[model samples]
Target: MRLHEHQAKKVFKDFGISTPEGKVVNDPDDAEKIAEEINSPVVVKAQIQVGSRGKAGGIKFAEDPKDARKKAKEILGKKISGIKVKKVLVEEALNIEKEYYVGFTLDRGSGKPVAIISSRGGVDIEEVAEKTPESIAKEELDPIWPLHDFKARKLAFKGNIRKEAIQEVSRIAQTLYKIFTDKDATLAEINPLVLTEQNQLLAADAVLNIDNNALFKQPELAELREETEEDPLIRKAHEYGFDYVRLDGNVGVVGNGAGLVMTTLDLIDYFGGKPANFLDVGGGAGSATVENALDLVFQDPNVDVVLFNIFGGITKCDEVARGINEAIEGRELPVPLLVRLAGTNYKEGLKVLNDEKLRVVSDLEDAVKEVVKLAGE
Candidate 1:
């Protein structure tokens, strides 16, 4: 789960990190009021989850309250990265003398949290890594041990942080690590941690992504989720208790396990077909669950064909077959369905599908080839 910038900065402030004071407003009038209250040049920033708001014209600077209202009006109804700008963060603008980047995220390769700092900030870190790798500093820390100030200072030095700002940068780095571990976050990033003309440090922007699995443990953080940031089909799938992800393909895939779903997608791609979505019904999926999954798949207008690949271990194949049949009963299916069932109650399941006059395949590869051909036609 990802928190919006204002939300992330609020969390950071709670943990002793300095950030520019801001107000989140949904109305242009409120934005103007907040800017007036600040009594300084303010920045109006769209609160969408995606990045590059500035490039998208979702970010604007206002010289005064009236200008703030104008800027907010321009951004309020616009869509950035397909998400509507329902809210904007209005904050005092800083006169940045220098900027740096600091972040902490899990390193899957080493199975530990890694801290990254860069002298060059205010841009995508991936670009920095690709264009100027030498300016970034990275450190992999032990999960059991706390990040020490000395280590953070060393990292700051390596990133070429100015000597005068090194201590403050190190302190922020340490605080960032604390937030990462304390919140069970997968990523905590502050881009353009800036030094003002007065040499004071502040976090100009904040981003935090909490581990989905850990949401149960952090109720408050979990409540900050914004459903608008998710694809509608994906959100619907979640409501039905299935795992789903949208993809850029025409074939819709439904399977019993994550691995099976992944393999189904790969097979579709290998055979000159594209998968429109990844839907995992999970273990022991019943008739209702399968029906729900199919409903979600058909909701995508891009789907040219639907494939159900079920290897029933705990989930009875007969139940899955019933679900498939139930979904097809009352509505006109816009696309064809290709099903491959194996494992528990496979005979009964096959009988159900056969009785319904649905196309059934025993071989996985044959199923893929047949679906691709049908989709093409």
Candidate 2:
């Protein structure tokens, strides 16, 4: 789950990380109030989950309380990267002498947490990685041991952080790692961890994404989901009790398992079609679950077609077909749907699909081809 900037900064501040004083406001008047309270040149930042809010005109500077209100009015209710900005974080603006990046994420290849430190910040880390690969310093830490200050300091030195800022950078990295482990976070980031004119290191931006699977153990962090999770599609998927991820594509996919769903997505891509969403109905799904899965896919305006692939084991294939039939029965489908069923009760499932006169493919590749052609992708 992605925490909003304000929430992430709250967590950071609670951990003794210095952050500019800020307050979240939904109304423009409240924004002005925050500015007045701060009594300084402030920045009005849209409280959306996505990054690059600056590029989307979601981050604006305000000279005073009135300017903060004006900026808030311009930002509130506007969509940034497709998320509606319901709130803005009014924060005291910083005179940054330097910007640095501190991040911790799992390096799947090594099966360990990796710390990424860099002097170049306030921009996409991917850009820095791709263009100036040498500038970014990475350390894959052992999960069993805490990151020592000396090790973190060496990392800062490797990232070319100036001697004056090295101590602060390393300290922040250690504290950030603690936050990463304490909250079961998959990502903990501080971009533009800035040095102010007063020579203080402050986290100018914060990003903390808790692992969805780890939410069960972290009750407090899980509670932030309702407040921080802004993606409507993801929220809807959770409501339906399905494992889903939205994608930028036209082909919606529903499958019985993770491996099956992934294979189905790969097939759609192989056929030059985009897969709109990754939805796993999981093992032993019933007709209602399958029905709801299709309903969820059809809700996406970007979806031009849906491909339902079921490789049933404990899940009955016939039940799956029945759900598909019921989903398309009364309402006119906004997009084409293709089903490919195999495994347990396969013949009965095929019979059910045939009775409904629905399009069914016996082969996965054929289904992918037909769906792609139908979607015109």
Candidate 3:
């Protein structure tokens, strides 16, 4: 779950982090009024979850109320990165002396949260890493120990920040760590954390991604999710009690576990084919889940073929075969289906699917190649 910029800023404000005062406006009239109230050069930023808003011309700097109104009018209802701008954040633009980046995210390989800070901000962090890797500073924090004040100070020092502002930076990092840990966030970031002309530090832009598994504890953050921007199939999968992710590809995949789904996706890619989605039926999945997975997969018009790679650990392969047959009984399934079922009731499952116009293979690699070939990859 990713919070909108305004929501992320609000969370930062709760932790005593300074952010620009702003009003969210959905209409031009409200925008004009807010701009007049601010009485300063304001920035109109699109209220969308996607990034690269600046590059998409979704952010505009206005010198006065009239300019703000005009920019707001131009931006409202405009589409940026495929998401319509329903509202704009009218904020007082700051005169920045320098920009920096600060973020807390999990380092998967180390199994701990890592703090990253860079003086080279206002640009993509990936670009900074590729061009000047030495400009960024990183520190890994143990989950059990958490981030300490001295460790934060050391990280700021490693970033080559001035001694005079080390305390301020450390304070901000500490607050961010608390926010990240307490909110069960997977990522919390402040890009272009600006040092104003008055030597005040403020977060110019903020983003926070909460851990989906921990949403029960953070109802307020969960409500900030943008459902319209999410893939419809994902929502459907959740309701149907399955793990699914929509991807941009031509082959549809269904499996019994995350590992199998991932391997299927990789093999599809390696065989010069792209997977349309990752559908993982849980360990105890029934026929209903299988039906739902097939329905979701067929909803994608780009899917030229469907692939079922099921290693029945808890679920019997025969039940999965029956569900597939049931799902395709009356449906206008235009594409071919390739199935590879192993483990429990293997022979029985083969018999259940033998009469259908399906290609069955026992070898995983051979099945993947055949599916790609059948899909004209």
The candidates, ranked best first by TM-score, are 2, 3, 1
Q: Write the per-residue lDDT of candidate 1 for residues 1-377, one digit (tens) a residue.
A: 77999999999999999999789999999999999899999999999876678998998999999999999999999976456788999999999999999999998879999999999999999889889988999989999988898999999999888889889999999999999999999999999898999888899999999988999999999998989765567668878988787776789999999989999999998999988888999999999998899899988887999999999899999999999999888777888889999999999999887445468999999999999998888
Q: Worst ten-residue run, lDDT, model 2?
A: 351-360
Instruction: List where candidate 2 sits over 4 angstroms from the true fold.
Output: 36-41, 50-57, 79-84, 96-99, 107-112, 118-120, 123-139, 157-164, 195-200, 211-230, 248-250, 262-275, 342-351, 354-377
| Cα RMSD, each candidate | 5.3, 3.9, 4.6
- Indicate the residue-level lDDT of 57 in model 3: 90
Candidate 3 stretches greater than 4 Å from native: 39-42, 49-75, 78-85, 93-99, 106-111, 119-140, 156-167, 195-200, 211-216, 219-233, 244-254, 263-279, 297-308, 333-377
- Candidate 3 weakest lDDT stretch, 10 residues: 229-238
In candidate 2, position 316 carries an lDDT of 93
Residue pairs in collision within model 1: none
Q: lDDT for model 2, on a 0 to 1 scale?
A: 0.90
- TM-scores across all candidates? 0.69, 0.79, 0.74
lDDT of 3 by residue, 1-377 (tens): 77889989999999999999789999888888998998889999998876788988999999988899999999999876446788899999999988888899998768899998877878999888889877788988888876788898888887766677778888888899899999999999999889899999999999898989999999988887878854456667777877777666788899998888999999999989888888988786677778788888877777899998988879898998888788777766778888899998878888998445677888899989988887774
- Residue 193 accuracy (lDDT) in model 1: 96
What order do you get sorting by lDDT, best first? Answer: 1, 2, 3
The per-prediction tally of clashing pairs is: 0, 0, 0
